[model samples]
Target chain A: MKSPFIAVSKSEFILYLREPSAFFFTLVFPLLMMLLFASMWGNDPFPGEEYGYVDFSVPAFMGLVMATSFIMSLTTSMAAYREKGVLKRFRAAPATPSSILIGQLSAVFAITVAGVILLLIAGIVFYDLRFLGNFFEFVFAFLLSAGSIAALGFIPASLAPTARSGVVIANIMYFPMLFLSGAALPWFMLPDLMKKISLVFPLTHAIKLMQGVWLGGHFWDYPVHLAVLTGFVFAGLFVSVRYFRWE
Target chain B: MTDNVVTVRNLVKHYKDVKAVDGISFSVKRGEIFGIVGPNGAGKTTTIDCIAGMHRAYSGSIDVLGLDPVSDSIALKRRIGLQQQESEIPDRLRLREAMELFSSFYKKALDWKMLLEQLNLWEKKDSFYSALSGGQKKRLFVAMALIGDPEIVFLDEFTSGLDPQARISIWKLVGNLRDQGRTVVLSTHYMDEAERLCDRVAIVDHGKLAALDSPSDLIAAHGGHTRVYFDASEGFDGKSLSLLEGVESFVNRGDACTLEVNARSAIVEIVKTLDVMGQGLDSFRIEAPTLEDVFLNITGRQVRD
Candidate 1:
């Protein structure tokens, strides 16, 4: 007998693989960003610099991968499932909503991890970047951050009545977070107001954790950032459970 | 064990001011095919939703096999299969994949291959949902509903838009469920479907129970008049036709005359009356009352309208 969680996750993974748009966002888009940013700014910023911006930008792109794969993708798919009556059908079946959500979030986590690994490899092979931190610690923080962001995705999914509405809600958070949370730029380059504004988004702490792990910084140094990300996880998950509509 | 598979007492559901299911009560017996027939907005779907634990009735006591539908929904779901009116699978999902996904939800599921074959969809198992025709899609839903080997199945408007061939195939499948001793609760406005498949039907009108009985009994009780039509091969007195023993009224449509008669043996009386009038009956048609007639009689409106 197969566990319902695994069964649902496996099918969700297959569905994620089958969608061309999921392919574009999860794997192709992030890889292109890595290649684009690495080639365009190959050399470092200073006069005597030898390394390009890719060395600094690669970890942020990993954060980008998590957001696209979990937040954007999960929100749109969940809303679409609700709209198509898939969620209601499952409710009528022996499946529990918790199992479905777990399976879906786990699938999203797995796919986003795969995309991140590929991005890291591309950065190493093309731009000569290397992980400077403990591998186990990096993996743990990466997954936790990804799970938190995926929970954030579920909030909009539970609230939106349709896929179009879900996209609208996701984009309102997604583009702004991508720009302000250091995924599209280095954190030090942001103006004071923008940096302060980014503090309110979960993506900011996610990027910070990823960058800290990549740069060999002490994992326990930023307890406040960890707490903020963890807060998002609890809050997002609660809201999703409270508002989800099976029909 | 109780013989009744489902029971609803004083069921009422309100959405703001509209009473979707107002003061309705019915019971479905074990191992029988029960149907709910009503026009659109007549509360058929609302009633089923409440029974299926999808909605909470404002005032009601609903029991399915001795369990409250809402409070014991988890257990109820394990025993009952539901094919909702508007439910659909993902367009990109293949038929086989969908069956596998749904089967995994249960502790012990029916074999997917067997279900596919039973639904006559084995060859299309590998086809994506978007690739299947509308009838095939409906069959796939039926297959999914039965995948868990549920004790009871609820099919809402199961054959609404299918062709005659497809409708007959589904009707046969539903009949098979009854033969296997599984209770089925069907809600549809198709009187012919209810007439053919249901052991008993509850006719609902304007959110209330208008009548409930075996289809034949209801037809016998409420299907008041038979319709008779005859071509006017010769000139006939229209007012004199109304005075015939069984004739309730007569309509003269120039070349033909239509008679609404109150008695089943009115056809014999109509022919005799035509014979005594010295008119040649070039063509005559006698139509017996059907479930549709019963429904029209009770509701005073067509099911579709």
Candidate 2:
């Protein structure tokens, strides 16, 4: 009768540390891509220095890292465990239900923090951006953005019957959110249709909120992003918990 | 009621159209190695789960150590030790850490190091669960179930699919448990395991109780008669031995004769009568009944069916 939360935490950390490939995918890989994109897009081509291309894309790219670390990672891991009968064993263990989930959340969230730090460091050194907002807003933005996408994650987590299915469903969101949210492609340069399409995805609001906090903009708009993201976490938690099958 | 460590009254469990427990009832005495024998889906695992407070029965009452398993699970769980069907430990956790984590749950615990050594898994202490072989995993599970030094131990399919050597090792370990004064309740399909280990056994099928008694007693009660076979001399006629005392029927084929003997000392008398008839045999053998025969007689189906 051990606490499942502790089991999950210990297990996740052991898995993360034991596999070098996971480190790259979860930490080094995402950060490397963020750097690669920023390097390719940093200097605006053939123009008077309007909004810096690097400056604009940096925030969006950082948003993608958060989405991948918490949202994509959780959905994939949780779904695989469910399909493999790992979750069912958790239910019968000495650990309570709450601890199991909290353990998973903590592991994913810890990775999210590492990704966020890498993004911030790259943004400052490469883009020459100021820390316009206090530490509080930065923390809030990270939590809020993670909350929204992680909520959306449960959608795939519940539906996927196998690990492959989980990965496929996660990609369906990964491409749309990263590209349309102006994380990779500039939202301003995209066609009017693309702008409208971006509005449909929560990542757009997420990146926008991050931008607002980055620029130290109006607080009223910030709460909208936070609220929407919070709502997503709650909705996802309800669905995944109900439909999740352990083998 | 007296000296009963585990009791069930009219237990019923069903899933859609199939009844898993079938309103069965039986009890296990304190400090005894009780066994349940049946094929898969005979409600063995389901019954143990209900008794362990993991699954709620559709109806009927189950009391383990005089406490309701379903209603008072927390208190019961702390006292009881369990080895759940299939593997319950996660693949990622290491064996050394697993013992420590499980041991933390109880106020008093057996020495994890000693138990690991006893299970021959001391070297595997640092090995993660996913990497262990099936037998290693089974031993680890058995070790964990004894961590709390529980008064009543529940083991489902305790020894199945194991080599004869491994099975014997586990059987010896189980015997040691009884020597230490802990009650063990297990379900197995292997008749040899039941006959050699259990103090009492309950036979179940299609979610219904078929028979319950000590292995020898059940065999004696249901076993029809002792069968003796031998090679007869030339010109042997079964008709002449038909009138022999306690001989139900006599059959012969060329140089072989088979006598179906009845009552106490039937085999001894049959041999003596055959000797008097000058029926010198190439080989003579007594075919006594085993638990398997009794199971077949009670259920009209094989043990694994």
Alpha-carbon error at A186 in model 1, in Å?
Answer: 1.0
Worst 10 residues of 1 chain B by lDDT: B232-241
The chain A TM-scores for the candidates, taken one by one, are 0.93, 0.84
- lDDT by residue for model 1 (B1-305), tens: 66998999999999989989889998999999999999988998888888887864468799897888778887888788888888887888889989998888887788999989988999999998999988898898889889888888999888988889999999999999988888999999999899999999999999999999999899889987788888886566777778878789899888788899888676787788789877777778888788998988888888888
lDDT of 2 at A154: 63
lDDT of 2 by residue, B1-305 (tens): 39998999999988777888999999989899999998888999888888887764469989898788867775776677878667456577788877876675566778999999999999999998889877888888888888888888888897876777778889999999999999999999888789889999998888999999999999899866777889877777767567777888888877777778776576677777778888775588888778888888888877876
TM-score of chain B of 2: 0.92
lDDT of 1 by residue, A1-247 (tens): 5788888898888888899898789888888977887777773544554334776677789889888977788888888898888888888887766788888888887888788779878877876785667888877787778868888887887777888888888889899998899887778799999999999988889889878876677669779878988898999889988877776
Model 2 sits at a Cα RMSD from the real structure of 3.6
* Native-to-model Cα distance after best TM-score fit, residue B33 in candidate 1, in Å: 1.0
Q: Each model's C-alpha lDDT?
A: 0.85, 0.76
Compose the digit string of candidate 2's lDDT tens values, residues A1-247.
4554665666676665666665667677656766786677764432653455555555676677767766577668767776776654444434444455567777767776776677668767777645555568766775777777776776676667887888788888888887888766667788999998887777888888877776566446677677777778788778867765544
Off by over 4 Å in 1: A43-53, B235-282
Give each candidate's fraction of reference contacts reproduced: 0.65, 0.17
